[model samples]
Target: MNSAQLKIHLLCRGIQLDSSVDLDADARPILRTRGGLASGIEGILPGGLSINIPVYESFAADSPFSLVKKEEKYYVFRDEEELSEIVLPPNPKFYSKKTSSGKLMSRIGVMQGTYLGIYPTDICEFWKTDPPSNCRFCSVGLNLGSTEDIDKTDADLLETTLAAMQEEKITFVHFNAGYLGGKELEILEHYIELIKKNTPLMVGLQAAPSADYSIYERLKKKGVDHLSFCIELFDEERLKEVCPGKSRTIGRKQYLDTIEACSKIFMRGRVSGEIIAGLEPAEKTIEAIDYFAKMGVVSTVCIFRPLIGTQYENLPSPKPEDMIPIFQHLYRTTLYNRIPLGMAPNIKVSIVMLAEEGRGLIEKKGFRLRLCEMRNSFIKFFISLYFKIRIRYGKIRLGL
Candidate 1:
């Protein structure tokens, strides 16, 4: 089916299918969505957007679309009619490797499309706060110690990162940690420095805004190519209600200020502020997109999934019809401001809304989208060229 419809279905009701770990139908060593909600695996849609659909015990048994494996290949079927061929990203070659300390390489990181994703720390301080202020929609607290080691070493990160680069040809790595305050930044920097020293992958950090803004400068010095502050909601009151710990500590003003400041340091598409759409008024989300675009930062939006076991698990996801306009607004705002649609093929991750908009830019070819694409391509080309030169010549040697 169409990109919008497919994305909406995946966001609202994950597909009801299952993959065997031992079979090619199973795309293992892949990123799990929404803190391992026992749904679908992350994969590339036929149109080239990264998506994770429901496959195991999904709520949408009645959904017209179902994933089926026929002769080792996976296909999306609509009532016994094939809709599209699906590509399950293969298990990375690095998954079999072990570090010097004998840690499984796959345990250190997982591939989300082409980007190697590492969760530096799963423990969030907010879980232990006197008032229990973790974000209502987040599952980081529930996942602590259950999925990954609470503390990982730099050696583990460095070895795992280089293996991904060498074996899987990954050019980017994203490090995520729940709120550990300054300690979180330290964990990220530790890995960033190690990975930059050992491999050529472009690094991205997802963490809370540091209390000291100067941490941004330090991270840049350590070779963090990109940064994201996940301010999940935009409206001041709703943000406080939904993300009590984040709003209490960083707040909307501080989040925006940090995003703006990091945008100045990283410039344009390199800095991103994550907004969870369908949580607040769509207009507020639109307003947040506008604000991020004007400052030349990527406004990465994820459709609100009421992930199981979280405080808001019972709340329903927003209607797919409602999210269509929000995605359209995001497209227009980012295009008008001349920011890139995504970080490019390898560096981008599978967030549904961004993928839908990227699909629109490719398929729709409307005047505004075409112009935005031209601008986006122009910028992306230069960025790619700059990195190419730096990799070969030891620095950017061009005068332009």
Candidate 2:
């Protein structure tokens, strides 16, 4: 099977760990994200397909696929047949270093794939309410304060990012916050500015959509490179049932309107509308991909992983067959709309199958799509080189 199919299968039907495997010594230390995915082993398959395979989920214990080490080399097997050699993300040496404020850099910002993912605020307010309106599929409240530090200072964040850039050679820093009563942008703006003025690293943010669209323009003007709004599910009724706090406080229309407004502000492929694929039907997920593509926003889909402490913990994970069509549509819709993709240099996300990586899932390509692919490949080279040069220069000069 191709890498894309392998990715889907491993994600759906998780792999088991052989007795010979010592994850603590060999793998990226699994940190359960408050975003509720990616609490697993970070492995890269052939052709640069990076994935965070489910290692902690209950379903992983009874899988056909398994991992074992041979002569210090990592390999994944399916039913006692070796399928492919696996490459693990090297555990960062800088994780042991500390910030100027005496906080461990790893506690301040953790690497999610190639980017530095920092949650710079306290818990989402939904989880703090008396009734607790947190999303049924989210584990933000459960994971925060226990797994990582909360309310990190801006100085602490900058110190951590610098350590990561200097040691790990990172190109991007992503800052996301929980709902701050409409002040997420306000609270994060200073942190964003410090990174923009001090480093050439590309900046990205994800939070609930702002009530005021002008805040997004301010963020863009401050050199924020990308912005994503998590809408969770496309079916409004299902969304209401699943994300009660969001639906009651911020209507579904607000997410769409905010996404459309920001799409025009940021260039195409710079804005994304995020949705979970398995919670709603595949058709709904396809509709969302089409909707985002039309609005000049790339759709970021996360397959629903039933995180251990979330309300949906007892629920079943989505099957691989069920998810193949959803991601296949992501490739088609993004390309059909002429959105530039695979332009960011070395931003490989382990948690989800990237839209660009979906190229492997398609069996046939039409002549028009072939032309589009060629154009994108050509664009990717120059654009990536530009960033590479900027990053190299920035390491010495320090700003874009």
Candidate 3:
């Protein structure tokens, strides 16, 4: 199977690792902090397709796929049959390094694919309410303070970011905090500025939307390269049911409005609307994608993984066949809209299927798709050049 297809299948049906596969010795640890959505074995499929395969989820126990090491090389197997060879992203020694504040760098920030992901604030307030109103599929509450530090100082964030950039040669530093009252953006701004001020690495923030649209503009000025608004469900009622805190506090209209506002502020692909596919109907998910596409906002579609301790732990993961259409639509819409995907250099996000990666799911691509790719190639060149200039000059903001 192709790399993207393998990525989709592995995401839908979690994979089991053979006992011989020592992740600690050979791979990046399953650092399951930051929204608790991911806790999986990470591997890079051929052609640079990096993925986080679910390994610890209950569904993974019976996965048809398994990772086995043979002759010191790792390969995924189907039962006893070898399927494909894979390599684990190295467990970087920087993870063991400590920030200036004595906090372990791994606890402060961990690599999610090629970028350093940091949840530099307290746990989402949704998980701390009287009865707990967290997202049904989120494990951030259980994950924070257990695998990573709960509250990371600005120094910790800067330290971890610099270490990852220096050692991993990372291109971006992503900061995602769970809901923090209405102050999520306000709280994130400090770290965003800190990172921008010190390093050449690009910054992306995924937080509960700010009540004020202007906060995004200020953040862009401060140096947020990208912004992701998790409007998890498109269907209003499903959103209410699945993300009670988001629906009540931020509201469905507000999320879309914020996304719309940012689209005008940032470049086409730089603004993303993240939606969890399995929670809402596939049709709704498509509508959500189209909505974002029309506004020049790329959709960051995350497959609904039934995280272990979340409220939806017992839920079944979506089948790969069922999700195929959703992703196929993802590639077509993004390409047709002329929104560039995979333009940023060395960014391979494993948590969800990227718009560009959806190319593998589509059975056919006509000249139209080819033309878009060609146009995107020029854009990618310019983007790479821009990043080079930014890294050298430091503190250059997107003219958007």
Candidate with top TM-score is 2
Q: Tens-digit lDDT track for model 2 on 1-400?
A: 8889999888887889888888888877888775767688888899988888887778887778999899888888999799988898778877778777787777788887778888888789989888999889888788778877885887888888888898778899988877778888888888889898888899999988886888988898899989989999899999999999988888799999999999999999999888998898899999999999998899998888888778997788899999998888899889889888989898988788899988999999999888889988898899999998988888888632
Candidate 2 is scored at a TM of 0.97
How many residue pairs clash in model 1? 2
Question: Lowest lDDT 10-mer window, candidate 1?
Answer: 391-400
Model 2, residue 166: distance off in Å is 1.9
Clashes of each: 2, 0, 0
| Cα lDDT of model 3 by residue, 41-129, tens digit | 87888878888899888999889999998889999888888778898988988888888889899998888888888888888889888
Off by over 4 Å in 2: 398-400
lDDT of 1 by residue, 274-368 (tens): 98888898899888888888898878787877666778877766776777777777777777787765544455455445632534533456787
Report every candidate's CA lDDT. 0.70, 0.86, 0.85
Estimated TM-score for each candidate: 0.88, 0.97, 0.96
Question: Over 4 Å off in model 1, which ranges?
Answer: 18-25, 29-39, 56-58, 343-345, 359-366, 385-400
Candidate 2 has its poorest 10 consecutive residues by lDDT at: 391-400
